[model samples]
Target: MFPTLHIAEKTTGSRGSLALLRWALVVIFLWFGCMKFTSYEAMGIAPLMQNSPIMSWIPAVFGVQGASYFIGTAELVTAAALIIGTFNKMASAFGATMSCLVYAVTLTFFLSTPGVAEPTAGGFPAISAGTGQFLLKDLVLLAASACLLLASIRPADA
Candidate 1:
């Protein structure tokens, strides 16, 4: 019924989409991870870390600057493993798992951080530009990470 559409779909398949997603994740991790080394980024994230019950220990133990560095290192490592995973299935699974965990923690910022909801907008569904909007993207990243994880763990023969 849709010969041209089917032909186009077959020509440019799921592999392209998967590669795009993987590369996009790598870029995000690398860019954000590199930024974490800077003082401004460290200072910016201080409020979120300080407010988080689960992440509060990071700033308390490592200090603001040190915490950023630690997180940055983890992000860089995840990006590296993902890149290497192109060839190695084990690396891919590990990277996907790490990405999942990272996004899960960041997603909590919506609940833990103050001023996430715009008071003038009546709060709740209205997310503030400062922290709320920024963290919202993590929802997509978390989904991508989960998809990668499932793809990585599936039997090779299948």
Candidate 2:
């Protein structure tokens, strides 16, 4: 009876760990998504977007506030899906795609500029100096999202 209980306890612990991982991922998405709304200006991201060729068309079509709202909505929705574990795969894939796009845009900025210095304060360094670092960070995020997507597809028993 003691041995049997030990095995059962071990199994439960494993399941608990998996559940914890899922919740941790959800919280991560939520926190990051919320940051987009709260910290854009402080991070100097507003100006970067205003100057970005990749996003230039956004303001022309929707105006700055409208464009910000659109992007913010996307982030918020993805975060919601992650938190609720609804459409997890789709949310994760969308998140991964967004990260990739950000990486590309930042990389472009980094390459086009010269002699930019890394920011000592918060927020990303100016693209010219921080493109490589920015891309590296986003790639890591993309990998995490991809892993979550794969995990969502796996059978619970597996």
Best by TM-score: 1
Deviation of model 2 at 92, angstroms:
5.7
TM-score to native of every candidate shown: 0.90, 0.53
Root-mean-square deviation of Cα positions for candidate 2 versus the true structure, in angstroms: 8.6
Residue clash pairs of candidate 2: none
> Candidate 1, which ten residues in sequence have the lowest lDDT sum?
4-13
Which residue pairs show collisions in model 1? none
lDDT of 1 by residue, 1-158 (tens): 76564444332226567677788999999999999999999999999899999899998999999999999999999999999988888998999999999999999988999988998899989989878899998999998888788778887665
- What's the C-alpha lDDT at position 121 in model 2? 47
- Candidate 1 similarity to native, TM-score: 0.90
Candidate 2: tens digits of C-alpha lDDT, residues 1-158: 36443444333245355456456655655665565555453244555566567876776687666666666666666666665554455554555445445445655554443334455544345433444454446545555554555556556676
Best-matching candidate per lDDT = 1
What is the clash count for each candidate, in the order shown? Answer: 0, 0
